[model samples]
Target: MDKESNRDEGQAGPVLTRRGFLGVAAAATAATAGFAAGARAATPGKDAKGDGGVLEVAIIGAGLAGLTAARDLQRSGCDSFIVLEARNRVGGRTLNHDLGKGYFTEAGGQWIGPGQTAIADLARELGVGTFPNLWQGKMSMVSGGACARIESKGGFDTDPRLTHELEEMAKLVPSGAPWKSPRAAEFDAMSLGEWLAKKNIPPEEQIGWATGIALSGGTAPARLSLLHWLSMINSADNIYERLEAVKEGAQETRISGGSQILSIKMAQALGDKVRLNWPVLRIENWQDGPVAIHTPNGVIRARNVIVALSPPLCNQITFDPPLPPRRREMQRRWPSFAPARKTAHVYKKAFWRDKGLNGWIFQPKGPVLWAYDNSPEDASFGVINAFVNVSALPSDPKAAEVELSRIYAQALGDEALHPVAYYDHDWGKADRWTLTCISPMPPGFLTTYGEALHPPAGRLIWSGTETADIWAGYMDGAVRSGHKAALNALHAMNERRA
Candidate 1:
């Protein structure tokens, strides 16, 4: 068996952040986590040359990256490309749970905000309007069996010294390639938790810092790489607020029809080019032109293939001749410890807004780690979306629902007592297409295998949110990677023709 094929065989599920134990859900939550689009609304290809006899590009996974590539190819007047998606639908990590009446609880990524211009511009082009997230009002904090509602405020109360120290360290790590930093090894060797221990942050302040870390990394602070954490800060332009703020921050805007609408619109524009249920089983002859992708339905051939899947999902597909040692190892070692569930509690109306509450909730320890208002723009109704930390929440469906509602009630008031409707989706249990909710990099992961995260293997290029130069794990990053990959594939094709 090839090293790549045999690498993750017999492994128990996906890689965990630490040992074979499950960690709690992240303290911080984001409505947006990915990008890539599809729409069958597009007209047929204009440039017959791009698709006449030979294909220009064949992309796998119709997430934002693949869709963007396909869109760009067609826009450049090239219709000689096709997008292959595994699921029966597009939008790899962006989905919405039905709630009827144009209301939806996003099952996948659904938010966008400042600094993520790639998706913003795309939304505008698609004619999709955006609405501000409902984050006005006091936030509720639950800890030690006591719940307290605090006024909405900017910036966390973490130690100023620690914040300053982190900012200084972040300067050393490049957002695109932290592994290339001069002190990469030093920073990468320690987990976020270990580094915090070394800093001797007092117990009182640790809770707040821990909350931010969990939210940012999508895993426990102890399990994340210090280097990876700092790299994100660098990507946010060295301002932590830009990275975590709900208003004027990364989680600032919501698409009019959920985040998946972008991909759906793109898919509509692409027409029949996107083949669903074509889960790629194997890829062969990638070193030369006319590469073949094997799926349960049939085989697809293309001059160039762009794999817009996360590393863990990439490991699921067997690559003929195998990927390089480093890429294989990177996939093998990549940790997917952030599998989580997002639930939405619906109400007759956003009563909290009337009470001057922001509809945000946080728990020091919880099955529902963090929550915020995800209601529709009209505010005719209420929707409180939250990250369910299984650690404290009951596993039983009914019990969990009751408990979650209780917590929400604590935050909003009696109005939260009984939601008119409830909706939730667990990404971990959903399917292999999206096994991990987020990639929480562990200590040394970047310095060791980060470089291999993006480099192409033969004609197969990697283009996922994780491969983005900036905002690597967000929707913006996904779009940027897709755009870059499309250009890269086109340039290579041109060079060959030349």
Candidate 2:
């Protein structure tokens, strides 16, 4: 959603009953009417003062999902809600790195592209400007320890034969109901490596594809599921080019003030209703109303809740009566691999562009898998970003810097050796609230347990990029999910009264 990779499988939920489904359909009208009337009070439990002492809603995680829900509720004249967040800041994956000189770059999620209209619309509404990604010039291509310059003609460097084959496979895996595909079980059973191995692509080409997979999915092909990968492709219009290419593809554009600003703006509108550092430790009484959310700041009771956090982070909160077996299993078996780190090498000028290079660098054997020109639009300063998984690299920052410097110099000559300033955020190391950068679904994880990704686990509704129906791992998908979760919470809560 934020990046072209469509990274993260951060969603999990359970199926609801027939009555619940009917209730959702029936309560939609009441929820809308309630919102239309004046409901703004900004306190969670005050709804119960006169009407049974039950708060209307309690949302967790002040990221895009939670913040979007809160903002929409505010707009709907519903203030009987509170957004509880564990971290001191907003924007889950979208973070900005101040690079000085009136230029700031995104350190986390911050990209918009073809068909990613949700985020684009949100940015436009929030008064955030957007710039197309610089994919115009010659890019440095590294393969088997050698580097060469290659130009982009709006086509991927991948083989047409390989790309076409994969694209055909993608058509079968619909974005909304990937599990319903006739070959779902077959694709779900195999890892990307096994599937590629069957295709018998040459080793060098395989290396290229592998790097793309890692950049696209935020994990290596060997660890990702063929089904999940195909589904992501489907989300991009069943075209492999839409998922991987720059022109008219997912890596098309970026927000001007960094993607995080969208959430920041949303939170600003909601005011203090968005509470930071209020990490929910436990959720009690979900089987009935007045669900108690225990946090370090104490407990807050609400009639409905939306856990708009990553599926794994959902596991961190102790559920009083425990989630359903399938939902629990979803969190238990979900793996957090390749926690990501992004580094922006800020320079005095765009030296790479002077050399006719667009600042796109792809390293096959890398701690920095994909490096590109992420310079500010003003071109006032140059910023080269390394979107990488530093799991196997050095732990120390200086040591890591030295290694990265060496790698950049090898690709961009001596000018790349030093930076005016280096801004990096290792979500892997720095943030406890964001445990995994993305969830690359492994073999059999979806089909065997895909049904758990929708429906509410009692009053605890689940949402995030990963749970999105269309662009499940992208920022657009995250926004779409937020809207959906808000509607679900509204509908379900109103259903109780009926």
List lDDT for all candidates, in order. Answer: 0.73, 0.72
Compared with the true structure, what per-residue lDDT tens digits does model 2 show for residues 1-498? 011111122210000000000011123223222221222333344432324555688899887888887777777767678888776667777665544333456767666678888888887787667777888988777655588888865445678887788889988998867888899999999998887878878766775687678777777788899999999989988878778766787877867656666776787667657776678899999977578988877678888898898888888989989999998898888767656877767677888888888887777666777788888777876778877547645756666666777777777878887776765567766667877766789999989778887878777888888888888877888898899888888787678769
Residues 369-403, candidate 1: write the lDDT tens digits.
66877777777777787877866776555566688
Model 2's TM-score against the true structure: 0.88
TM-score of every candidate relative to the true structure: 0.88, 0.88
TM-score attained by model 1: 0.88
